[model samples]
Target: MSRTSTESVTPTPAVARRHRLPGKALLGLFLAGFVSILTECLPAGLLPEMSRTLDTSVSLTGQTVTLYALATALGAIPLARATNKMPRKHVLQLALGVVAVTNTLTALSDDYLLTLVIRFVAGLGTGLIWPLLGGYAARLAPAGRQGRAIAIALAGTPIGLALGIPVGTWLSGLGGWQLAFHASAVATIATMAWAMATLPNLPGRPAEARFTISQALVIPGLRTILFALAAYMVAHNILYTYITDFLSHAGMAGQTGWVLFAFGVTSVLSVLVVGTHIDRHLRKLAVGSTAVFAASVLVLALFTNAPVLVYVAVAAWGFAFGSSPSLFIGAAINATGDAADVAQSVTITVFSASIAVGGLTGGLLISGLGTASITWAALALLIAAAATVIGGRKHAFPRNS
Candidate 1:
């Protein structure tokens, strides 16, 4: 009898073994993600209080938020590489400790400089945990379960966006920005404690497979994937940063908060949808959804002023925003053969840079040009990203590479 290719290839004993992550480890991973992101998004809701406490303009305080994004982007590459030799659990635990302490410093500061300094340190620590979790998630998940595992971990994005800002604002109203950081520190510490007890070491590669940050960046598929994902990210975040302001400008001033609430819920649902579906058709999902995402951005930009149209635009953006993160995660894992963490670190480094440039430029663009101009800029980014997706279909990424 002739053997078919599918039947000829035999599975090794290691490949055939049943695998599952322990329940407690999964919870610890998700909690680590939740707190790490809260440290980023919480300050968004507390920006007004940050201004008063630091004796700066609300706009200047907004730069602190941008600073975290900037630092995190630049920091991810070197920090991720440096920690390659360390235990995954130790690196993350150390990073969280820094967050806890730095967050505490921000709470105690009466001086503006002290607050900024503490935030800067906290931002670097914040950078380390995200990619570590990516690596950790890849390691912890069973062979066929990486997507859902990552989704469960990545939910922190929307949850942080949904809970962090609103809760921080609510907390600030009751106590102050200082209290908000105190709460942040408490959360960070608790996550670290849980991680120390729960997360596996997720062993490092055989020496032959190990690569440096420079080597990782040189791979063609990895580079292209990062560029495309970054372009998509830059556009999405630029639109996201000014959404609340856009809602007000669109003449829905009183109902903007409700619009934001709608976005959060829709965004969470979108994340779940993508997390569930991406595995079966990653290429189509990345391309089609991104096209839809781009189209919605265009629609939002041109029709923002119609009150009824504004809600629809917000939900569209929310859904896209939710789906994009997981899509990018799936893309990164596909691009790098076995080093999803390395791929994740590279992806986020690009993501961070995209965010930094988008945030700073969008702020300036809004100030000098207008909100309409900001959307035009984002439209250009999306157009470029759409082109990349077209090219990617011809030269698929290294799925395990």
Candidate 2:
């Protein structure tokens, strides 16, 4: 994946001249991503209620998230490949349909094992959704503005974390844990319909144009980007997965929604900032986001005695993390050029796997070392991730990007 590989995929000047974002299609993708993430993390904010209702320990309940990520990681590459020749719009609609159905079933399930199965299927839906979104946004974007288009499209992740989870927590308080899932199902269904009407029905990859997972993996800078993505996502999830428990431990049990809301507000700001600067300063944004995240965790590790400090740290964390998917997937695409879709599938696989690792790691840390240790652990991982991003400047996150 040389610079020439990147240049090869750049839109011609004529195409660039007319390039403008397909706002309706991108918004449809945004909502699809929003629903997918909202479904995935809804349980985080309602863990205790879900645990009690399911007759399982909180740790075991957390595996719902882990299992979902594991399913996504396991399925992304194969599913993306399988659907390569299908209509892109149809593939998205199908995936969104599965998400809606599975989330509804999850809301109805009384048996923990049954709920796990439902969530697993939902994860498969998201596996497809994640890989498609970046490429889909790129396809719909005008020539030079693909970065901004992708930023808008992927904004749903942070929004889901920032607003969706907190809102779900509030709704669970008014109704029950199941209400969040029901809401997610309704939202997903609506998004699917919006996509059908608004999104372009692009043709899928022709056989000769398709690239394999192995081929995507072998791209020079791709593995570095994946490694950094894994580190960043795992660290984020360690804290994110068990956020409610961590808050309770820190004596902010009643402030979970508020805290997350604050995080969400800044996360939106992050998207705005990244969208503005990503195309010209991709390397700087990558380094800066990782470094900022590490610093935020360090604050979390050392300053929980003050609630204001905690809020500030968390807001910073959200700002740092909000644009990560956009940054990483963008980097991967730049690296893999014409194989951008395949690269996206591989990136999503690593991203999902990291979530699983983070959830499992967070659970273990809570059981063994306790919640306080999670921040420290996350801090260390962020440090390593930042180092990788900083050192890989020659390729992975090239300064020129």
Candidate 3:
């Protein structure tokens, strides 16, 4: 499990030069990343309204988030395998195209079941997008700048969550949930066009070794990081999936958009800070951020009445969670070397699965234990995630090459 045991795989000079298109390509990837997350999380902010419109319980509307995550979890590996031979740029375009079309259909659909099915389709595209984009970012980066490059690309998640989710929520308030989806469709289409114009043609390399789930499971570093990631994400989604509801319950209903906006703003700031240091301090960054995130959730759980405290907690949570994917993905790539794609795919699967479980469990908890219980539930999971990192400190993060 030591870093020394895993050999670092270097890219050929010719391949590196071919894939390197840092400026515009990185920006395009960032927007694509933002759109991907915005599409997945759009339902979170509009759950109550969507439930009323579809004549269903809020808990049932929440299942749409679960469904999308489950679909992405199930499809990530198979879809990655299927497209392993295609050019990376084409795969990205195709995935974004699916996002655009499915979201458009989502906006147009009036039936709950039809919307769920279309979201599931969008999930399939999202499944392909995450790992491919991560790998693509890694490929495009110039040597030591891989961590920052991936951070820039993956910054979309928080940016989307920070800006897109709140904006979507506000738009839904003005024009209904359908308007939110329509906007997502428009944004995704624009991202696709930018990607097409900017991204270099990145053909896949043939596998150097037979990469499989069983192999990934046996790698000690990979196993520990994935487990830690699952726990962290489960904690994150539990609170995230129901934040609007929690806000409403706290009598802060009118402030949901503004609160989420504040959260996103700090998130972007945190990613920028973490991006610079992740290559040198992967394990410390992982452990420290999760600890901050967990502490923030505890504050929310315990100090619900103080508005100032609540906003502080939200900003802390945003800053901590915002920097996580890049930290985790960078750790995974360091762990798996030549099998980075397999590692990335497995990480995405674990991530999506955790989101599915967390959202579903949060729904059940909300129905039975009430909305406030979710933060406590999330804090417990985050504690476990932190322990995983501390316990596997030596093995989970290898030395930067």
Question: Residues 153-259, candidate 2, lDDT per residue (tens digit)?
Answer: 99998888677667777889889989988988999989988998999899999999987778778888999998899999999989987787888988999898788
What lDDT is obtained when candidate 3 is compared to the true structure?
0.84
TM-score of each: 0.89, 0.93, 0.91
By TM-score, how accurate is candidate 1? Answer: 0.89
The local distance difference test score of each candidate is 0.73, 0.88, 0.84
Instruction: Please list the residue runs of candidate 1 whose C-alpha ends up more than 4 Å from where it truly belongs after superposition.
Output: 1-23, 206-208, 394-401
lDDT of 1: 0.73
Top candidate on lDDT is 2
Report the candidate with higher lDDT, 1 versus 2: 2
Tens digit of per-residue lDDT, candidate 3, span 323-361 = 788888888887788778888999999988988898788
Clashing pairs in 3: 162-264
Which prediction has the highest TM-score against the true structure? 2
Candidate 2 Cα errors over 4 Å, as ranges:
1-17
Better of 1 and 2 by TM-score: 2
